[model samples]
Structures are given as C-alpha cells and as structure tokens.
Target: MSTAVATRSGARRIRLDVRLLVLALVMAGAVGYLMYTGLQGTAASYFVTVSELQARASEVDGRRVRVGGDVVTGSIVRGGPGEPIHFRIGDGTSELEVVYSGVLPDIFAEGRHVIVEGLYRNGQPVQADSVLTQCPSRFEAAPTASSS
Candidate 1:
C-alpha cells in the first residue's frame, strides 16, 4: 500500500513538470513571432542607392524604396504653382533624376544630403512623396561677443 501511494505521487509530479515545460515553449514562440513581424514591417521599406536600384530595376521597380544621396549641384528646378519640383540626386559616381510634389523641408536645398522615399519604375525618375534632409553638422554658429 505504501509503495502504490508513493508511485502515484511521483507520476503526478512528472505530469506537472511536463505541462510547465510545454507552456514555456509556447510563450517563447509567440513572443518570437511577434518580434519577427514587427521588424518585417520596417525592413520592407529597404534602402538602396541609385546604382544599386539600377542594377536591380526588375526586382524593385514599382515598389516603394528609399534612396539616400546628395542633391546634385544645379540639378534642382522649382516649378510654378502646383507643379512638381525636379532634381537630380547622386552618389558621386552616379546620379538619378527625381520628381517630388510635396512641401519640401525647410532645410532642403541643392548640395544637401537627402533621403527620398518614393516609387521607382525602371528607366524613369523616382516619383518622390517625401524628401528628408540631413541635419547640418553645426546646428548654429557660435555667437560673437558683439552679437551676444
């Protein structure tokens, strides 16, 4: 009778341990899945340069992408009311033409480093929906004693 009672108790403890292990595995899997999906949303908007896109046009055409480059000198052309602004962005060795229609950032100008997000089609200028300029290395000039 004593042996039988001890065996039953041992079996019950084993079952409880198994259940706890299974629960922990399920929780870990759920958390990992959530993190993967969150990162996918951001990674989908991949970043590439003009040359990189040109090399893989068929793969990225018509898809939204981000291209970072400097505004090519003398490539900026402002349009009349309601017209799109045209410009060329380059990575020194190569360049791409872009057309953007939106409120340009106050800091946007020729020769500034910018990141353009828009749709890209093979052999055509990007239809940019947004333009972002890099913050200047010096946010403000040091005030002279007279100015202060």
Candidate 2:
C-alpha cells in the first residue's frame, strides 16, 4: 500500500510540471504576437520637405507619404466653393504641384507652411487625404491706410 501511494504522488507531480510548462509557452507566444503586431501597425514613414521628396520620389512612390513645404506664392487656385485645392509647394530649389480634394485648413493660403499627405505616382503629385497648414503670427500692427 505504501509503495502504491508513493507512485501515485510521483505521477501527480509529473502532470503538474507538464501543465506549468505548457502554460508558460502559451503566455510567451501571446506576448510575442502582441509585440509583432504592435510594431507592424505603428510602422510608418514621416514628413519630409519637397526637395527631399523629389530626390526620393522613386523610392517613396506608391507608398504612404508626407511632404512639407512653403506654399508657392501665386500658385494657389481655389476651385468652386468647396472643390479640390490646387497649389504648388516649394523648398527653395524646386516645387511640387499638389492637388488635394479635401477641405483646406482655415489658415491654408499662399506662402503658408503646409504639410501634404499623399502618394506620388508617375512623378505627378497625387491628391492627399489630409492637409496641415501653419500660419505665421500677425500680432504686430502693420501700417494701415488710416495710420499711413
């Protein structure tokens, strides 16, 4: 009877050890999968200037892109009341023509800082889904007609 009880206890210990090992393996796999998916989802390119984008257009085409530059003066054409915006963005040396079919920001005007998010296809600027405009401060008073 004593020998039989000892054998049963040893078998229970082995079963418990196997269960713990399997549980640990499952937890590790879950953690690894979460990490891999998180990294994949957050992997994205960043904003760049028009000149840099032009140089890397071959490599960046057909992928998600963000281009930032100053809006070229005299290049803004407002179509209709709420139609697509057409403008040119430049980085001192070169300019990129851009067409964005979304509502422009309130501060989106000629000579403003703009960041366009879209893809460049076949060396042409594709329309972007989003546009960001950063306007310069105008707190200082300019000489108005009354003052002048």
Candidate 3:
C-alpha cells in the first residue's frame, strides 16, 4: 500500500540523517584532537633561568625544559668525531653542565648567550636535544654622553 511504502521511506531518511550526524560529530572530534596534539608539539617549552632550574632540580629532572645562560668560558670540550660535545652554561651565580650530540650552531662559543632545550639528568647535567645561540652584536651599542 502507498501508506506503508511512505512510512518505510520516512524511516529510512531519518536513519540516514542520524548516521550523518554521528559521522559529522566523529569527524569533528578527530579534527579537534589532531589540532590539540599539533599545537602541543609546536608549543615552546617554558624558559627557565640557570638558577631557577637549579633550584627546581628535583621537580624538573627527567622533564623537558628550556634553559638560558651564558656559556662558561674554558668549559667546552670537543670529543672525537661522532662524540657528544660537553660544556657548561651559567648565570652569574649558578651553572649546569650540558651534553649535546648534535651539530653546534655556527655562532656557538664561550661566553655567548645560549638556550638549551632538553632534559635534566642526575640532578646536574642537561642532556640537550637542541642548542640555540644569540648573536653578540644583535643589540645596539649603548648611547654615550657627549662631552660639553
């Protein structure tokens, strides 16, 4: 009968609409999850000073962190080919040893401002995954007072 056929057709449409709605919600959730994870991956790690990092050694050990300090002069030791580079980074009053196994930046050197991102191990040394350096001349020279 025409009435019976129309009833079945309406039910089918309703079922299809429900399925589509569920699918849309699932897709949206997947996209949201991907975006959240992607942003997390690209987020910058929290920057910590050498002294702060030292003070929080127990809380931060084995966790990823970013530390900024000047490279300690006379502390860089280059190993044989393919070996890790060892150095010390310090604030004026606190310092930590860093061991890196990657290629050093061209401007990396002693007494330079550097940021190392990695994990702190054994409550002392940082096992650096990346090393960044700031150009010494990037800032303008201080203005001098003219003699009267």
For model 3, residues 1-148, the per-residue Cα lDDT tens digits are: 9999999999999999999999999999999999999888777655789999989888887898899999999999999999999999999999899999999999999999999999887566899999999887757899899999
lDDT of 1 by residue, 43-66 (tens): 866677777877888999889879
Assess every candidate by TM-score: 0.72, 0.67, 0.72
Count clashing residue pairs per candidate. 0, 0, 0
Evaluate all candidate structures by whole-model CA lDDT and list the values in order. Answer: 0.91, 0.85, 0.92
Off-target runs (Cα >4 Å) in candidate 1 are 38-46, 80-82, 139-148
TM-score, candidate 2, is 0.67
Q: How far off is residue 74 in model 3, in Å?
A: 4.0
Local lDDT at 135 for model 3: 81
Q: Please list the residue runs of candidate 3 whose C-alpha ends up more than 4 Å from where it truly belongs after superposition.
A: 62-64, 134-148
Output the TM-score of candidate 3.
Answer: 0.72
Model 1 gets an lDDT of: 0.91
